[model samples]
Target: MPLILIIDDDPMIREMLITAFHQENYDVMGADNGKTALDIFRTEDVDVVITDIIMPDMEGIETIREFRKIKPDAKIIAFSGGGSLAPDGYLKIASSMGAQYTFQKPISIKVLSEAVKDLLGSCKKKL
Candidate 1:
């Protein structure tokens, strides 16, 4: 089974994603902040990362950079509900930072799941 790491400060969002991925038969892990997420990333064989852009602590952009440094080919999906900058602004930064996919807040779990599956399919092709 593929392992997915979900990082978000909002408990409800984290739980929602966890449950959705679980139903999809993916092994899921949750982190409330970028710092905690990175620690888990270092230890686990995470296939894809779904992270919120405006999280407290490390924030999503920095986390994406760190993930790239650790694994240049890491699969990442970034999302935001908007902050000082609009969600689009943050998502653009995430794309430049190597996030393969981006979404706005109130994301459809079905779409996110399809993105994960598509990303994994592409990864398999690369191997």
Candidate 2:
């Protein structure tokens, strides 16, 4: 099964995502901050990362940048509830920095699963 790492500060959101992904048979790990997420990333064979833009320790944008450096072809899906600026601004930056997909807050798990499948499928093709 594919491994996925989810980075979000909200406990409820984290649990919700975990449950959603688990139902799809994907092994999932959750982190409360980008710092911890990075630690897990270095140690695990994470196939995809779903991160929130606004987070403590390290923000998702910085996380995505580092992920690209660590693994250039890292599959990333970034999302945000919009901080001071609109969510689009942050998502746009994430995309330019190498995030393969972006979504605003309250994303449907069904859609996220499909996106993950599409990304993984594309990566396999490239290999």
Candidate 3:
């Protein structure tokens, strides 16, 4: 089974993603903040990461960079609502920072799941 790590400050958002992945029969792990997310990444065999952009302790971009340092093969997807953060280019920056893709807020589970599938498919190794 594949392991997915979810990092978000909002408990609601974390819960929603957890439920969605659970429905898909994915093995899911949840973190309420980026620090915990990184901790999980370091300790667990995470296949992919889904993280919220605006988080306390460590933001998504920084998390991506750090995770890349620890696990260059880790696949990450950054997401944000764009409220008070960068007005634009959130996804672009995340991609530049090594995230496979980024998602705007109010994301559809179907779209996110499709993106996840596409990313995993393009990987050199099968999960």
Candidate 4:
């Protein structure tokens, strides 16, 4: 199965994403922050990354940047609840920086499943 890593500070968000991807049979890993998520990447062949925009440590945008340095062609999805602070078109920035897509918070499982399938399918073809 393809591997997916989920990075979010919110416990509920991480659990929800983990449950969704697990049910789809993908090997899923979760991290409480971007730093831990980066560590998980070192130990796993993660096919896709779903990360939040903000966190207490490292921050999702910085994580994405470094992930690209090590794995330039990584497949990543930037997700966020926004929570009040946004650096203006953050999603667009993420896309330009290498994220395959940016999804807003409260996404339906069906939508998420389809997006994950599409992104992972594309990534698989590259592999």
lDDT of 4 by residue, 1-127 (tens): 8888999899998999899889888888999898898888987898888888878978888999989987887889887767556644677677778988787777677877777788877665332
lDDT of 3 by residue, 82-120 (tens): 756562477678889998878888878898888777777
Instruction: Itemize residue pairs with steric clashes in candidate 2.
Output: none
TM of each candidate vs. truth: 0.96, 0.95, 0.91, 0.89
Task: List per-candidate RMSD values in Å.
Answer: 2.0, 2.1, 1.8, 2.3
Q: List the residue pairs that clash in candidate 4.
A: none
If candidate 1 were superposed on the true structure by all CA atoms, what would the RMSD be? 2.0
How do these models rank on lDDT, best leading?
Answer: 1, 2, 3, 4
Q: What is the C-alpha lDDT of each candidate?
A: 0.94, 0.92, 0.84, 0.82
Give the lDDT of residue 52 in candidate 3.
Answer: 84
Tell me the lDDT of model 3 at 90: 72
Stretches > 4 Å off in candidate 3? 122-127
Instruction: Give the local distance difference test score of model 2.
Output: 0.92
Cα deviation at 121, candidate 2, in Å, is 0.4
Better of 3 and 4 by lDDT: 3
What residue runs in model 1 are displaced by over 4 Å at the alpha carbon?
124-127
lDDT of 3 at 23: 89
User: Given candidate 2, what's the lDDT at residue 78?
Assistant: 96
Best lDDT goes to which candidate?
A: 1
